[model samples]
Target: MTSLPQQTDKKLGLVIDLDICVGCHACVVSCKEWNTGGYGAALSDQDPYGDHVSGSWLNRVHSYEAGEGANARVVHFPKSCLHCDDAPCVTVCPTGASYKRSEDGIVLVNEDRCIGCGLCAWACPYGAREMDVAEGVMKKCTLCVDRIYNDNIPEEDRVPACVRSCPANARHFGDLADPGSEVSLMVLARGGFDLMPEQGTKPVNKYLPPRERPAEPSSCGKRSASERESTADATGFFRWLDQALERMG
Candidate 1:
């Protein structure tokens, strides 16, 4: 078993907003595209065109139905390695392949040191780790370590690929240890939560709960039929005028 760092300088992690995630899978696709060739081993797709198709992906979106009847809503959950403070995946690695960095608390695997024993995957309760069938090694998200710290890329773009590519801007990345950081402040304001608190992993990543649905108006705010029609007419005229202006410009 490998020993984890007693303390890390920075608890770098992600904060996902459940309120605005549209389940577009943009983050998922972007993560796979960047990480497959960015760092570690290439993500392998087995029998891609066949019926038994499978591939190693670091990020995945899961859809769930919550509430009932009028309150029913489909929630899209994006999941990945939580980079737990007490990471079981790191401790269970017999060959010391899986390790969490003391500098940023990012969990990573050394492919050369990994024996493909699958112990790390089993140890991870969140099912974040996956085995690349072709490469015969366990693979997981590295938080885009290569891109985040790379001086070759622009300073403004120094974030995980998923965070950069998220169309809904639901994903956030920053130092969680800093309470003044944007990510930390958002977590505090939105009542962010962990995946499995009972497991005692103390995951660094936080998830913002879905915002409460606004109460529906009983009678459309008591708008008269003629007033509604007039509003619609004005809206249409403005929309048409805006399009004409764009074309002329």
Candidate 2:
């Protein structure tokens, strides 16, 4: 069995804002693109473009409809490794392949030491770990460890690929343990929460809850003639015309 670090100097992790994630899957694509070639084994897609296509991915976005009527909205949740402080996956590894870094608190797998055992996957509560069938090894998010500490890359571009490629700027990365860090402040201000605190994993990543929507008509009722017209204005010409007409009238 593997043992965890006593403590880490910096708790490097991500702070995700649920309010602005548009379910674009940009993070997912960017994560796969970078990790496939940069670190670990290549993420393989079995029978791609076929009916039963399946592939290994480090990040995934899930859509959920919340509330009802006027408050109903789709919540796009982006999930990956949390790099827990007390990582169950690490402790469950028989060969010591799974370990948490005492330097940065990043949980990682040593592919060479791994015996293609699925114990890590079963131990993780977040469903963050995935097994690469082709390689016969378990794979997971490394938090872009290769990119963050690399002196080769520019300092400004050291964040994880998902954080850099998020179209809505919904993802943030930093040392979460530092109270003055941007990620920590964001988490504090937004009342960020853990996914499954009850499990006692103590995940490093935090998620900002969705903002409250203004009280208004339900989606069914809100689609008035003007709203329909606005939707029909593919290029916003009619929208501008309507605005101008309203200003004049």
Write down the TM-score of every candidate.
0.86, 0.87
Error of 2 at 160 (Å): 0.3
After superposition, the stretches of candidate 1 with alpha carbons farther than 4 Å from their true spots are 216-249
Report the lDDT tens digits of candidate 1 across residue range 107-219.
99999999999988988999999999999999999999998999999997899999999999999999999999999999999999999999999999999999997875443
Q: How many residue pairs clash in each candidate?
A: 0, 0
C-alpha displacement of 235 in model 1, angstroms? 22
Q: Candidate 2: where is the Cα deviation over 4 Å?
A: 217-249
lDDT of 2 by residue, 129-237 (tens): 9999999888999999998998999997899999999989999999999999999999999999998999999999999999876667433455777675454433578
The true-versus-predicted C-alpha distance at residue 149 of model 1, in Å, is 0.3
